[model samples]
Target: MKQLGSKIRGFFNTRLGFFALAVALFWAKTYWAYQTKFNLGVSGKMQNLLLVLNPLPTTILLFGVALYISGRKSYITMLIIDALTSLWLFANVLYYREFSDFMTFSLIKGSSSVSSNLSTGVMGIMRASDWLVFVDVAILILLLAFHVIRMDTRPIKKLFAVGVTLLAGLMFGSNLSMAYHDRSGLLTRTFDNNYIVKYLGLNAYTVFDGVKTAQTSATKANAKASDMNSVLVYLKKNRIDPNAQYTGVAKGKNVFIIHLESFQQFLIDYKWDGQEVTPNLNKLFHESDTLSFDNFFHQVGQGKTSDAETMMENSLFGLPEGSAMSLLGTSNTFQAAPAIMDQQGYTTAALHGGVASFWNRDNAYKSWGYDYFFSKSYYQNIKNDFLGYGIKDKLFMRQAAGYIEQLPQPFYAKLITVTNHYPYPLDKKNQSIAKTDTGDKTVDGYVQTAHYLDQAIGEFMAWLKKTGLDKTSMIVFYGDHFGISANHKDAVAQLLGKDSFDDFDNAMFQRVPLMIHMDGLKGGINHTYGGEIDVLPTIMNLLGISNKGYIQFGSDLLAANRNQTVAFRNGDFVSPTYTKIGSNYYDTKTGEQLKKLTQAQKEAVDAMTNRVTTELSLSDRVVNRDLLRFYTPNGFTKVDKSDYSYTQSKALEMLQAADDKNKTSLIDKNNGKSTMNEYKTDAPEMAGLKEFADSYSSSSSSASSSSGTTSASSSSATSDSSDKDK
Candidate 1:
């Protein structure tokens, strides 16, 4: 036994043994990650085993180079490399918990913002068991500190180390080729980061993400304004005039846009266990004043929810790849909804319960010409109210009541709900709906949270009515994107009682609810073949606004001559007659594949394909080149982003200014007191948080003064102070 122990110690103390140990530790941690942290899907046993082994060669090639150096310096280099690798793994674990995604180089570059946005609440996501990832590192450090494995003086033979690295490289190449053979285009045309990590290891994904990021940056750097000219001409030539009857239908009215997070249209009238999934939404769908579109789909790409916002606000498409909000939002100029509304004397604000920095929204909102933004910080008593991305939908809507009342009349405001987000987890106490026995927890929880969201929206609508705003305001409710992904399709098929969901069903699943309600408008379900991109132009037309001079890609959906080709970001398109997804063509009426089309049908499909490509490419050019910076619409002044800030105090500043001026501010009209008390809900969380609501109400009243001149001066002084602090 003593002889065996001595031999083991001698081997560990040698240079080659130490190199072997490093590689072994890296492989173990990577496998651990693959087994625990990542959801690589059920890609069969062989593919899953290949994914576990794929990282080994890359790990060796990366850390093996240090073997060429001599003495302690070599050891130090290996230690640094291992430490960085461990740190990267650790970061992916944390990031994946939040985004269900691995870290990209772009996200890493923006880590400072992410770190700043993180709160103590993040500690809840960290599991005590996750410390297993560091067990090997800890053991290695302890051994080195105790001199149990002293740094060997001898260097590894350079030729052997180089040969090992080259052999590993060749093996990795072969492994990747096999992966591609198993999953066609495994390395190319990957839309989801999860797919890359699924087939190739996280290390491979990081390298791939870095390459994609570099390519995007290079494209942006080389982009020119002239590249958008063709796009502009196409958009102009294809632009349709607004229907005379519908123009100015909701002119000079307040606009309340409720963004339903991860909501799909199937939930609109869906029934499960004899209970309607969205009872309130069902009522809204049938309301005489509502115009609900049954066929409107959510056309978003990688940006997802943020992309929906971009398309709705600017009538523009998201990037073909990464999130446009994160990649280009801060730099890109936009002819957005808020900016267009500003021309018509509308006060624009965006209220989201999430961190403003999540998608770089704090800066993006400024560039989008939003005069006010109420982010996560604006909500009271929310330190414990959050679930996934931000506060619960119930709490968010309840908290937004005070802020909404403060906005000036004829305002453009958006309320973004997040409780219905993916992996939808609802507290047992909050789950009023029955859970599905489909065995898919995500699908089961989706229905419950969606019901909760509907209740929240119903409460908010009631509050609008109590405040007499509902009568005068146009309420637009739309789903941002899909709640369930293709992975859950089988379970969803069972839930929907389908034999099997094919591509046709998948296409239909993309449909999201778009409802517009105004007091005097005639209501009926409109079978409009539109997407989120059409929202801006539709809203503009109803409000007596025109996008004729602006570079908009979507036409007004309400227009009699509206161009209804719903172009998706991924070069797919859907029209009333046909649905073209990638290379497949389907009859929209029958949902049957058209393997061989008539010449006229073929011509129509070809024209649409060309149009879709042009639209997407032009939108990319406009965003990539920041074309709006070079072209301003006639009679529209370019927005000075410096004029806006989303700091916590800005909400109060705006309210105070409105009070001092005794102008369009709702607070001043309400006699300097918040109308939040008028807002009522049955949310359990809200009942206990009444004191928090009262505080907001009382604070507003306390800040008001009878003397207008003195109040104006004080507000001016406060604004100046805030500016200096900035």
Candidate 2:
């Protein structure tokens, strides 16, 4: 075999061999998955393990198959390179921990963990099955590449030559394609001079890509603060009440707002798998008016659950046009229920089982109007028996009960639960709640947590009954966001059952369990179009509160007038940028894009979109920070220091700091350790300088000197302006 020309040189230059290597090492990735499962530390959840095993193997297969179809050389380095590269891919996914986290059982809970290998194998099977076809293609490529590369003979020389030519062409094409994707700063300077010179009207040979960089920056700058306010005003002119109560919910009620961590809609199906998994939540909706907003969606223009909460609770919209949750707690002020209640004469309190401020929750809540904030420390020293992430629902519930008893007559208290958190790692060691025999993994943990929380809620409600405060109080309960993406898909599949993927069925993620349980309110399923933003106005409407001058994205959940939805892309990287109306997506940034919705429908949707945008901007900029004042779009009469959060550094310098100091806290005494928030909903909330934020949270008078409002707790939603926590 005589080699001539640049054939040998070309083969070495190509990455086809590396692709083959990746395929060979795909099987060995099992060890990585197993190691991550058990040794990810006490804080890690089973879900983290699940996240480890996703998509990498399949990608490895793709690399191998492409190489087999293209390359001429058979090599041992292929396997070695593949394993190393596969590990790299695994590490990246684990670091981001977004899609995978939602897919896996939480490692911290160890609910997904198993002492017995049999159960663990069953889960492993599921993870392995997802990549089976990819593996098959990879193995086939390796054997075939070996046979074809070393083929010998003379009469068959023509066929062999033809095969060789085609293989070389394929390899070259694949490499070129790969290069196209690596268009980073360094890459462009090195590779794409010709294309850059043409499209961008630049000198290809020059290293200065400054003009292109400036243009991209300018486009991003165009996404200004008012984008959020535009949505708010548009909402008033077209959708529900123009002026609605900004905050200050019903007083004296034990408001249990369990943002069921990653609680997706797929979990709600009445698929009594011989027994009901979510029997309590599903059944609760029966006695309560379940605001089953079928067309409602997540206003997540940016982060996942973090974005969902910011959009919903703050009555804000859009992501910060950058990374979501990364800039949490920094927003000066936003419309949170507690903030609203604080304005309308309510002593606000917040409770979550997680760390004090994982996602800047501590500072962010202070901006949201909570007078008292409670996290893991609030429930301190008690057996955090459940896991490293948070205390069990039962423990949280007990604390909530005590807080409720201490609250003034007209008070607001929120309790966010973690029992139903991923991997549903049941702390069955000491809990009194008897576990039901549910064979399904997802169903078992979900049901158990749901049931336990349900019992806790029921006990709380029973206490309210005993105190005689149950009749007048209004309670809002809903899942903050869906639990997992897979659960949402599975639910959609359950509806369609073994068919093509339905984008519309993606509702399980956006559509969650929402209910307003009040003594006088009618009980039944209210299957209207609604979402997180709409909850505020709906509650106000029921209480007969007049919100004539407020600016918010929410409408009365029970109101007859229908409202549309607006969406945000947590980390936007495109145009048409996922801005939408309810479930229907159309790109008419300046006009009504969806013809399916009539003039009224168009108005409703456009208005909502604008409102969501407005609220997001306003909250982000820290407007309407009056703790006692019900904030309107214009209600934010005074700018406080807290409302003007400054521009933060984009990179995680703290991670670098930890590296520099060689000081890390997560190392387990027994094994090892770990962790992960983002948002934007405001009316142009960015401050030119940090000095401007001085007056953000300043309220002139305590509730005592007010024309309306009680000292620590108001008697009711105070009608007087002085009650506003400005």
- The candidate that wins on lDDT is 1
lDDT of predicted model 2: 0.43
How many pairs of residues collide in each model? 0, 82
Which stretches of model 1 miss by more than 4 angstroms? 1-67, 70-103, 111-205, 218-224, 320-322, 382-388, 499-504, 560-610, 647-651, 659-677, 686-726
Residue-level lDDT of model 1, residues 60-148, one tens digit each, is 88788788888998877888888788878887786566445567776556554444424442564466756667766777778789998
Highest TM-score model number: 1
Alpha-carbon TM-score of each model against the true structure: 0.78, 0.54
User: For model 2, what is the error of residue 553's alpha carbon versus the real structure, in angstroms, after optimal superposition?
Assistant: 2.3
Writing each residue's lDDT as its tens digit, candidate 2 over 1-726 gives 346535643443335433433433453444343333212211134233323433233334334433343233323434444444444434323322323221111111222211222232234224443343245346635644765333211122345435544654564445334334432332332212223222211111122333443443454445445444544455556566522332333433434455655555554644433555455566556675333443354445324555566655655543332222334344343555566665665556667655554555656665665666655543323322334246566555544443344344455667777666555566555333444333435434555566555555565556555545566566666776654443334434543354543333343335567766666555677655556666666665544544455555566666655544433332111112233422344443443335476677567555655544444444443322221223344443322425322111111122123222432111111012110000111112222422212111111011112221111122112212222221
Model 2, runs deviating above 4 Å: 2-88, 91-233, 242-256, 264-273, 288-298, 318-328, 428-444, 487-501, 544-551, 565-726
